[model samples]
Target: MRELFGEVIHTYTRAQALADGSLIDVTETAAEAGFRLPVAVTRTVWLRYCEWPEELGTGQSTEGRLWDVLWLAVWAARTAAEPSARITYTLGVVPVDDPEGDPVDVRLWAAITGEGAGGAPVVTIGAPEDW
Candidate 1:
């Protein structure tokens, strides 16, 4: 609290992060994938799993990859025995450069933020370190 920390010097908010590209809004796509609340992903997660470079010459599409991530996240959230603000799950992503190679298992975490858009809770998917 401000009382404990004294006067606030600076603050970096979620809105700033979203505006600066640190967080990528995926609410629209997530809604299509069956999410009721807002959703976002860290830039690291987006680049690692969802961003499909055209130079890769692979059949992977960004839309499809994003859907896969959200779908898996939804399943993890729904199957959780206890209600929690955070959920961790693993998703296998084939490397863009090595599409034929074995899929790499990436651990991801989705957390509900206390204050998000319109002062509502929002889901943020990111690598464990990012949490």
Candidate 2:
């Protein structure tokens, strides 16, 4: 993590690895940024994601579905353990670069472990496609 203008930023390599399924443990990285729990980190991300383009559903509300996804991610994170815990979720159909074209689905992948110093929990988050 790099501190710029008093804000913590994840390096491009770290961000790419997170999305590409390479760098899975984020304990030390998040700790350095002042985040302690996977849910806390995920919630912060979800809130930011909510600011993006609207994703209208066919028979349901997109916001409702997103909340459900957020809930599941948090629940999964709470139970995450070292060596095997993973949190995977799909954001259904979302607006893509072209709003006039068909929307695409967004997927998030994460893992948690206890390999951090002092057995601190580690969390990693990534999306398969741009949101």
Candidate 3:
């Protein structure tokens, strides 16, 4: 298991950040180096990380999905970007300990600075327990 921190904001939020002048993208960058986690699995892990809003509903509910929450978080970051904004995200990958089975990567991320009243950020991405 290893912990990694990224100084860069999410590419999903790049356009808004550039428009706000909070961040400037000199060039396009490749996606983060890691397995591309699925949205359904990411949703499950994120739900485990924090409480779900009544409106957003739960994992079993048919309301807000992981993609929805992710968009919400990105928008929050873009909207909230300011001279003092220090919001950040950290990713932790825990590899499967099995010796015979192929190693599986379980990834999770948290918003470090700008999360508000609720312990959860406006949005978060994570890996499911099974995936």
Worst 10 residues of 3 by lDDT: 26-35
lDDT of 1: 0.88
Q: Against the unseen true structure, what C-alpha lDDT does each candidate score?
A: 0.88, 0.48, 0.33
Worst 10 residues of 2 by lDDT: 39-48
Error of 2 at 91 (Å): 1.6
Candidate of highest lDDT = 1
lDDT of 1 at 66: 93
The backbone clash count of each candidate, in order, is 0, 0, 0
Q: Rank the candidates by TM-score, best first.
A: 1, 2, 3
lDDT of 1 by residue, 1-131 (tens): 87899998998878998999989999999998888888999998898899987777567888888998999999999999998989999898987767778789989999988658577899899998786
TM-score of each: 0.92, 0.37, 0.23
Residues 12-90 of candidate 2 have per-residue lDDT tens digits of: 4434544564443334434444446642234334433332444632444435444544555565555667335676665
lDDT of 1 at 80: 94
